[model samples]
Target: MYSSLTEIFKILGIVSIGSFSIVGLCAFLFKKLFDYYLKEELARTQSNLQLKNEKLKIEIESTKQNKILAFKTLHEERALLIKDLYSKLYLLKVEYEKIKLQETSLSFEQLNSIEKECIEIQKVVGLNRLYLTKSISENLNELIKKFERTNEILKDLFSIGENTFSSMSEVSNYKPDQEEIEILHEKLISLISDIIELLDKLEESFKLLLNIE
Candidate 1:
C-alpha cells in the first residue's frame, strides 16, 4: 500500500513539472514573437519617414530651381527691352543732327517722319517703363518732351500756312527770316546739347544696370 502511495505521488510530481515546462516554453515563444514583430514595425516606420524626408527635399529643390529660372528669364527680357530703347534713342539722335545741319527748306514729309519716330520711342518707353528705374523713366519722358519741342520749333521756323502743316506731302520752300533763324538756331544748339547730355546720362545708367565696365 505504501509503495502504491509513493508511485502515485511520483506520477503527480512528474505531471506538475511537465505542465510548468510547457507554460514556460509558451511564454518564451510569445515574448520572442512580440519582440521580432515590434522590431519589424519600428524599422518599417523609420524607412517610411526617411522616404518622406527625401520626397520633401526634392520638392524644395524643385521650387528653388523654378524661382531661379523665372528670375533669369525676366532679367533677359528686361535687358532686351533696354537694348531696344537704346537703339531707338540713337536713331533719334542721328535724325536730330541731320535736321540741325540741313540748309534746305524743311519738307512736311520730314516733319511727319520725325513725329512718327518720336511716337515710336514714346511707345517703347511707355510700354516697358516698369522695367526701368523711376529716374530713367522720368528722364526718358523729359527727352520726349524736348524732342517734341524741337519739332515744334522747326515747324514754326519753316511752315508758311498758318505756321502749321496741312499736308504731309507739302514742301515748305519759303525762307524763314534770317534774323529769326539765327536766334532759333542758338536755341537749337542749346537743345541739341541738352539732348546729348541726356543721352550720355542714359547710357551710363544702362551700363550700370547691365553690369558693364
Candidate 2:
C-alpha cells in the first residue's frame, strides 16, 4: 500500500506540472494575438490621419488659386474704367481750349454766336464731367472695398501681393499743384497708368497661382 501511494503521488506531480505548462503557453499566445491586433489598429489610424492631412493641403491650395484669379479680374476691370475716365477728361480739356481760343479771335456778332455755342458746350461738358466723376468715384470706392477683403484673404490663404492699390487711391486723391496739373494732363492719367501696371502684375500672379503657362 505504501508503494502504491508513492506511485500515485508521483503521477499527480507530473500531471500538475504538465497542466501548468499548457496554461502558461496558452496565456502567452493570447498576449501575442492582442499585441498584433493593437499594432494593426495603430497603423490604420495613422494612415487615416495622413489622408486627412493631404486633403486639407489640397483645399488650401485651391482657395489660394481662386483668390488670385478673382483679384486679377477685379484689377483688370478697374484699370479699364480708369482708362475711360482719363479719356473723357482729355476730351473735356481739348474742348475747353478750343472755346478759349475762339473767344479771343471773334467779332461782336460772331463772338455772340460763338459764345452761345460755348455755353451749350459748357452745359453738355459739365453734365458729362459730373456723371463721369460720380461714376469713377463710386467704382473706385467699390474696388477699394473689395481689395481690402481680398487682402485679408490673401494674408490668411498665403503670402502674396501687398495692398498697393489702396495706397495709390489715397495718393490720387491728394490735391494737385497747378504746375503738376499743367505738366501732366490730370491725376486721372497717372492713376490709369498705375492701374495698368498693377493689372499686369495681377495677371502674372494669377498665372503662377494656377500654374498655367
Candidate 3:
C-alpha cells in the first residue's frame, strides 16, 4: 500500500507538469499572435496617416497654384488694356505737337477740330478707368488738362505772331510759358514710362513666380 501510494503521487506529479507545459505553450502562442496583430495595426495606422499627409500637401500646392494662375490671368488682361491706352496717349502727343507747331499741309481748321474732339483718349480712360491704378488715372487726367491748356497757349501765340510754323519755331518771344510746356512734356514722358514699367514688372514677376511651367 505504501509503494502504490507513492507511485500514484508520482503519476499525479507528471500529469500536473504535462498540463502546465501545454498551458504555457498555448499562452506563448497567444502572446505571439497578439504581438503580431498589434504591429500590423500600428503599421496600418502609420500608412493611413502618411497617405493623408501626402494628400493634404497636394491640396495645398494646388490651391497655391490656382491663386497664382488667377492673378497672372487678371494682370495679363489688364496689361493689354493699359498698353492700348498708353499707345493712344502717344498718338495724342504726336497730334498735339502738330497743332502746337502749326505744321504745314494741316489746316488750322483740321487741328482745331482735332483739339476740340480729342475724346478718344478720354473715352478710353472712362471705359477702363477702374482697371487703371489711381495714381496713373489721376495723372492722365491732369495731363489731358495740361494738353488742352498748352494747345490754347499755342493758339494764342499763332494768332499774335505773323509767320508760318517753320519761322514761328524760331520766335522766342511768341512762346508763352515755354518752361511750363517743357515741364508738361517731361511729366507726360514720365507717365508713359511708368505705365510701361508697371506692365513690364508684372510680366517679369509672373515669369519668376512660376518655375513649374
Candidate 4:
C-alpha cells in the first residue's frame, strides 16, 4: 500500500506540470498575434492620414492659382477700358479745337457731327463707369458738358455770319469785331483750360488705380 500511494502522487504531479506548460504556450502565441495585428492596423491608419494631407494640399493650391488668374484678367480688362476711354477723350478734344479754329461758317453737318460724337462718348462712360473711380466719372461728365458748351459757342459765332474765310490761314489776317469774336474766343480758351485740368486729374486717377509709380 505505501508503494502504490507514492506512485499515484508522482503521476498527478507530472500531469499538472504538462497542463501548465500547455496553457503558457497558448498565452505566448496569443500575445505575438495581437502585437502583429496592432502594428498592421497602425500602419494602415498612418498611410490613410498621409493621403488625406496630400489631397488637401492639392485643393488649396488649385484655389490659390484660380484666384491669381482671376485677378490678372480683371487688371487687363480694366487697363484696356481706361486706355480706350482716354483715346476717345483725345478725339473729342480734337473736334473741339477744330470748331474753335475753323475759319469758315460752321455747317449744320459739322454741328451734327460734334453732337453725335459727344453722345457716343457719354454712352461709353455710362456703360463702363464701373472701371472708373467716382471722381473720374464725375470729371468725365463735366468734360463732356464743356464740349457741349463749346459747340454751342461755335453755333453762336456761325450765326453772326459777318465774316467768312476760305482757309484757316486767313483767320490770323482778319480782325473780328470786339463784341462778338472777343467774347466767344475768351470763352473757348477758358473751356480749353478747364478741359486740360480735368484730363490731368483723370490721368492721376488712372495711375493710382494701376499702381503705377
The best candidate in terms of lDDT: 1
What's the lDDT for all of these models?
0.78, 0.50, 0.63, 0.74
Off by over 4 Å in 4: 1-32, 102-105, 156-183, 201-213
lDDT of 3 by residue, 142-165 (tens): 766765665554455445233555
lDDT of 3 at 14: 100
TM-score: which candidate is best?
A: 1
How far off is residue 31 in model 3, in Å?
1.8
Q: Write one digit per residue (lDDT tens) for candidate 1, span 51-162.
A: 9999999999999999999977877777787777777777777776776677446776677777898999899898888888787788788888987887878877776346
lDDT of 4 at 112: 75
* Candidate 3 clashing pairs, residues 3+ apart or interchain: none
Clashes of 2: 0
lDDT preference between candidates 2 and 3, better one: 3
The best-first sequence of candidates by TM-score reads 1, 4, 3, 2
Clashes of each: 0, 0, 0, 0
- Runs in model 1 deviating more than 4 A are 1-31, 160-173, 182-212
lDDT of 1 at 159: 69
Error of 4 at 41 (Å): 3.4
List of clashing residue pairs for candidate 1: none
C-alpha positional error of residue 124 in candidate 2 after TM-score superposition, expressed in Å: 17
